[model samples]
Target: MIDGALAPLRILHLEDSDLDAELIEAELENLEHPVVIERVMTRDAFAAAAVADRYDLILADYVLPTFDGVSALGIARAQCPDIPFVFCSGTLGEDLAVEALKNGATDYITKQRLDRMTRTVVRALAEARARADKRAAEAALQALNQTLEARIAERTRELAEANAALQAQIVERERAEEALRLAQRLEAVGQLTSGVAHDFNNLLTVIAGNIEFLERAVLDERSKRRLAMMRGAAARGASLTAQLLAFSRRQRLDPSPVSLNTTVASMRDLLQSSIGGAVRIETMLQPDLWPARVDATQIELVILNLAINARDAMAVGGRLIIETANVAVAAPPTRPERPSPGEYVMISVSDTGTGMPPEVLARVFEPFFTTKEVGKGSGLGLAQVYGFVKQSGGGIRIDTVPGEGTSIKVYLPRDETEADGDDVKPEPVDCAVRHPPGSTPVLLVVDDDAEVREVTATRLVETGYDVREAGSGLQALAFLEADPCIDLIVIDFAMPGMNGAEAATEIRRRWPALPVLFVTGFADTGALAQAGVVGADGIVQKPFRDGELERKVARMLSARQAPGLRLVADRGRRS
Candidate 1:
């Protein structure tokens, strides 16, 4: 499919002769595609059309009764710089054509050979379409990046306010229940932030997908570079959203049995180098340490973040100790929010350096509350640690003095299930499946946003799929009931009246075996379950990359053909 298959070719012609204007219109109609021509015989008509309407190409006669081609070209250039301008005159000389070409005209042609006008108009329209696509991609990327930045700023302010509230509670000797409720409120904010990030991801997915197509359609080095920048910005936005989800304890994770002692031992050399040789390092690894169920990558980050913080605390040289232990707690924890009574793998880190004061310690785990100078830290390290531990069914304790030192302990629940045996879990089937031989599948895309729905449909059509679109879930249901040949359904999660999940349920009731792929900005499992969504079924988040949705759609369709095919559930989170 062509890049601008749906975009119409709009032309603005400046010619005082009615016969010449009609000739130009006839020439335009001779081309394969439809063209809309607006003729202006006077400078006032041309000026009014230039401001009031948008055009793909401007064709002006070299010599007009009132204004020349140069004047019209100037006006078009100033009003719509990206639009193409060309000279179509009967009394044009070689020298005059060269001068006009020098003055931003696309191409100069004589009336005797009006046949050349066809090729010129085609080339100009192609370039104009390319520019329009680039501008639209840039605008979408800019809007997403700005949103990511604004959300980060807003989160920071909320953290600061929570800190102030905590300090006030300390002065008034408020009950512990109040603190618990405050924590719940913070959790609610995290949930809201996560949802917004999910939606942003969906948007990015659409933008990124179209960008990939645009990159292949264009060959210029500058256009490729600009698209690469837009891709980078989209990637950065994805990272920001993942970090927010991590802090909120809503990010999907894959946990396994891991030995705390061995994990720390493996990172000894790396941590030593990361913290520098100035601080002496010591490890007290307990023999036969119990295994804990956690995400090793996240655990490694927690340890590294603590080590980095310890190194920074000691301005000069100091001793840093990392120790592990296996403990069983018979009684309940001092804090009700801590982990339950059970066997746990305890990992502790201690440092001999200047410690945080009472006020600083109180707000240490709050997101974006950093003590380090500006540009030095993001203030998400400890917050991430806290969220990871809690989400992994673990607890964290902090003990510190004003100037002596600080010790932090992390307790992870022991994995004592029978499957703790030395056996590897089988990996899921690859979801990047290709279509079968000589198969042209049909796809139905449902979304409330018109731009997203149209772009998504256009992209799918480009990829060899018969694509149909609907503005809402009700419309999608109506289409599904009427057309029973659609092989797959791609629907948005959040919508007015009937939502993606509701639509999925209704479809399942009618078309029991049909495959459905949800495009959503929501990360809540309970809400998804209520909407009949599962990890087994494919899901593509908002603001996803160009290839992501296609791969997922193809995978879902393939999985439908062959049962017992599984997909990698988690999309994986970024810090």
Candidate 2:
């Protein structure tokens, strides 16, 4: 590309039909940039031109009498991987196009959609240029570093102390840069995993909701058994998705002030049984340890995962020490993911086992990245621990030496707002819905996903509430403005246009006394907190157990103290 005018591009076209080749050339010529297409009709010609790397792009037909586009793509990738490869064929199907993309084709198009070729070609070339720019920038960085080191070495005789100080600074900067790179990579992976998990959660909600309805209608012993199995399978799927979300730091967590010393002490017998007779487990508890506000169950799981990982590393018997203490971090350690300087409750898990090398350490926090043999690990062990700690306002650091041992330290922010009864958790009391003892509470369910909205609305309806449906936040608002008899709202967090939080803000402005219960598959907690939605009274995660939503809704509505919220009770409930 040129600033004033588009530069001419050299394109290699592989098509058996002369007419099709001419059409391809015509579409490409229509581009703002000039194009010089070298057309090839035979296997020999195509292979020779592809390996030459003399073209900016390659366009090929999927099928040919003696040659194929896939083979041409392979040759191009092997010889000149930088060149963008696209397939334009009359016989190309959707599945084949997907396969071609998976096999490294830049883009795929059918003859019927040839108009898309020009746009695709333009975008592909731009992306290739971007990739080239990134490579050049990285190369420049390396060159600069090399030049600095060489100059420092040359000046060592005259400036020995200065050289030594500069060398340490250089080493520290390099470590920080490496850590930043790793953090960026893991963050990108977390984003993709969270999106996929959100979709899976929505699907699971539908399946589980329908199954709950079916379980009520069918009571045959054999049928009941099959349904139970299916429900269990659904639960397993939800658990897998939850683990993925946990790795992404997007899973809903219930945090409380808990003592890690007590947690570890309780898990002692379980840890012994889990690790078997191979690894010797020990715990060192700090007497006056400050309580950390974290999800107790998740922390337990994190400890167990660390224990199991240690056990796996030590094929033969080894020592696994779990220690906890209060520490004031002066500064964050040189790690990609680190905690801020603050008071923290630190837990160290040290193992005398086969330690990880640099390559394994780099990807230790990535979801589903494991060095163990296939069937032995799901690779989510460290990822879950990493995400949980990070999400709980904490940091984790790993110290390992090959052939020596490994130690992982987790730093959780000390809970400063602990009250007297914070340690005592209340047992669940069955919430029997009784709104003013004589009226049904009207609830509005808002969601962008139709099936999810239906499932949620149905559940609320079955649970003895009068439920209304809205496909979006705007619609929900409209319903509320028209119907003041509505007592509470159950809204999805993620939506197009105005989201649930935005609507909730507007709803609060108009109806301050009406409470909201958020129903969500996945939520970006930071964003919600910024929007002031995280502190809202109620939230029920998606794929929730049978009674979870009901309990939350019942409690919220009951707290409103009447059949309808606020002024609505004064106006009387609608029939």
Candidate 3:
């Protein structure tokens, strides 16, 4: 309510009798704070004046000539909704006045109660203003609540969108991590295969050379026949070793954008020779097929391996079909394994052979899991195919039934660029034919393996080197301390007490100008740098060729005289 000290009450008096209006005006004038009263006799006059200016209170007579007090109260309510309306009637009874108060009238005054008129008007006006202020406060509070709800809803939507994006990023990261782990596992298998292949190649070289020497020495027919069998077995072992290296992905790869049509056309003769004259080979290559990114030689190997498997499946003659086509994976496949979606060039090999059951098909790509007889297959063919396709960022699928034929599909990623024009062919090098000269220098062979040391020393001596052998780092150090003129030190990396790297360190510390060569079967060699052998004179992988050993020794000895510090020469040799 507005304090009476700040604002005076504005009263509208509606009555037909001029005397009654004057009486109410005089009653209000007697108050300490003056009230402003505007008198209107007709309803038309009341409404016109109320539209121009509103009142804080309404005083109406019960009976007017043209209208009644009830009609005047309505006019006041329409113009100023919260104003107090009171009735002052000469003929209105106590019951009728009570009825008016129930119908929105604040209070009523009879003609007999002239003294109570002023106090009733003041109290009625104060109460009406209090109700008005409360309604205003409630409206403002409701508006503020609506605004807060809107803000919270908007923030909730933003959080939902952010959560969805975070989930997508997590999925992509997990996929990349899985692919990296698979690659590392393949690399570990490759390391093991490389070690095995190196040792097998060296053994084959010895056995084959010795067999040829015995053939020249032996004259009996039975001895020659047994020697021929041994040579044949050694050759087969060498072939199996090569396949293992290929399946483990250890063989060197030279990748290029290759046309499937051209590669298949060139391999017609070789495939015929390998598969024999029984199976009929057919090719259905798309003329405008997209090129694939892969090593051509490895792809050839994959084709041959698949053809051989097809031949084995069909003991009798059967038709083999090789088809090439372009494919696009627009969405993830509906398999449990979610393969990536992209463009690919698919090469499918289908054969009308004795098909495999589900059991055989499931284990076809596992290494050494073969269906052939014990001595007939090495079981690395399909494993090599799997490794090749996976390494090229692609996938493979196989379909087979018990009685129906079998089909294997290899998907290779498509390259957008055209094949290069040069496309120079690579020349094959025969390592056995290129033997080093038999004039070996003074040599020091160091190995923790007693057998390896003895064999290497014997071979070097036969090639005309004054050979010395050491079975440990301490033994090599002792030998070096006694004879400083030893030409080269071939040290093994894995020794029992002092390793080859430590032995090389001690040798260099004593004789700064000494030449040291490391021979290791292990893949990682960075440890040599940390052991103070910062620059090695040379590094030959273990089970090396006679040519490799001889060439490395000659190169290191010749580099020592090239007018620089021996350490500098070592650095140049390593580079």
Candidate 4:
């Protein structure tokens, strides 16, 4: 029902009699909502009017001059399917009206009982509105379903991406943990190797010194030749020990500000000749490269070792390219092993040769982890390079593809100072000093090793000094306290109970004017200085040549006699 007073209801009437249409309109006028009606008599007018205009209901006559009520109902059903259709006729029989109801008409009323017209119209309009509401509800539900499905799909994609990023982060964390473990293992091994080399160097020095004495005493050609062979074998042993020291980062270094380009350029001829005609050598030195503070000779050794490894890989010949550049690391590098953000001097060596596989590359920096045949390689080459670079406060990166090639990059921290020309050159000196004879300088030699103590005493005696020996720092201290005649003290840096530095500290307190020299295999000068033992003359490595020992001892003694002269030690000649 339209409440009888709302907006007008639009109605279309298909009736032949104008009076009959007015009667039907009057019947609807009593109902809710004002009625607006259009009368079309012929079937053509009814069809044309329904198509052109929208309406709320359709009232038609069962019988007409041009068309019947059934024809009008059919046209209204086709043109405006949702509008209510009703037949009103004076001669509409009950059976015909029932038949019309079954054919899509809402209701049919006889003119004799036209009072029911308003009730039928009200019921038809209500049903029409209910149908429209149902359709609208179904359409809104369909739209909601589509929106929910699209949102679900987008959320699923975002979750998948987050999962993938988490997986990548897990992998990187695992790799970093593994690298840390490898570093710890290498450090422990280096410490052990250094300890063994320290003792081995002392033994080798004894053997070499005795061999020299035998060579001078034996005059026969066969014996002299045999002694020379023994000396050569000892020298080779010394070289091997040196390699161990290098890999363990226990070898002495003379660090200075040096240009990477200049160092690489100077080694060009030597590298080419050593690698031979089979391999081609090239350089791409950056003109404005920054200087780095490092041991120039050791850096050259690192390059040479890498080049030699490259040459060996290229059995059929290949090209070796060395490049230097100044790099600014503003963020973490693409390679994880490189240093953190700062300026650096980068040296890259690339070779067009057989590259290493993943497994070999992983273990390449490990000492004695070689891929070569039984005796072809000692396997310390890359290890030495790794130690040298790390000890010089640098990082190394290696990139290789199985069949492509290999490129190794070394990044050393930048030194703003200019490069020194004599960075790699050893200090020139006359080590053969004539021993001055007056009162023989009473010297005290302290070492935990009995053989080292005996050998050192023998060398001092041969060099025109009265020598005394002690097996430990405690023994040396006891000896010095008992006899105040000792002119100088030669103590091993590392001892069992009390170290050389501690003994030196005690000696300095008791005898402030006494000069002391420290001997060790460790190359950590900063550590030694912290222990109150400083100066190159005051520190000497084990297995030193007789001339080196003599020169150092002579210099210290000369300084003692002339209190005015300052005692200075240059590591260049000490090595």
Q: List the residue pairs that clash in candidate 2.
A: none
lDDT of each residue in 1-575, candidate 4, tens digit only: 57535678898888888788778778887786677888887867887888624898888889987688887878887888888888889988989988998999988788777899888888888888788788998888888888888888889989999999999899878877777777778888789878888998999999999998998799999999999999999898887788888878888988886766657755767998989999977666554456688888888988899999988888799899887778776865443345668778899889988899988987788788898889889888988887877777777889898777899998887874433332433233221122234557789998888788888888889999989877666556545433445668888887765678777776676556678888788745765676566668787777886588878888888887533322221221111
lDDT per residue for candidate 2 within 1-575, as digits (tens), equals 22225667888988889888878777776676777888898888987887655888899999999988888888888889999998999999989999999999999889887889878888888888899899999999999999998988778765987878899999999998987888888999999999999999999999999999999999799999999999999998998898899989997899876777667766777998999977877656654467788888989999999999988888788999888888888976778566788888998889999899988988898888999998999888888888899999999989999987899999987877642325433232112232444567779998988899988988889989888877667556545544545678899999887788877776676566677888887887765664456553577888877799999888887777634224421110111
Clashes of 2: 0
Residue 33's lDDT in candidate 1: 73
Question: Where in model 3 is the C-alpha error above 4 Å?
Answer: 1-8, 31-54, 71-80, 111-114, 140-183, 197-248, 252-254, 259-291, 296-386, 389-575
Give me the overall lDDT of model 3: 0.72
Across residues 482-533, which tens digit of lDDT does each residue of candidate 1 receive? 3445678888888876678877776676555667888877755676677566
Per residue, candidate 3 scores C-alpha lDDT tens digits across 400-453 of 776667888888877655323343332322222332333345678988787988
Q: Each candidate's TM vs. the true structure?
A: 0.41, 0.44, 0.44, 0.57
What does the lDDT read for residue 257 in candidate 3? 71
User: For candidate 1, which ten residues in a row score worst on lDDT?
Assistant: 566-575
Candidate 3 TM-score, C-alpha based: 0.44
The best candidate by TM-score is 4
Clashing residue pairs in candidate 4, if any?
Answer: 4-32, 4-33
TM-score preference between candidates 1 and 4, better one: 4
List residue ranges in candidate 4 displaced over 4 A: 2-27, 35-128, 154-162, 329-338, 416-575
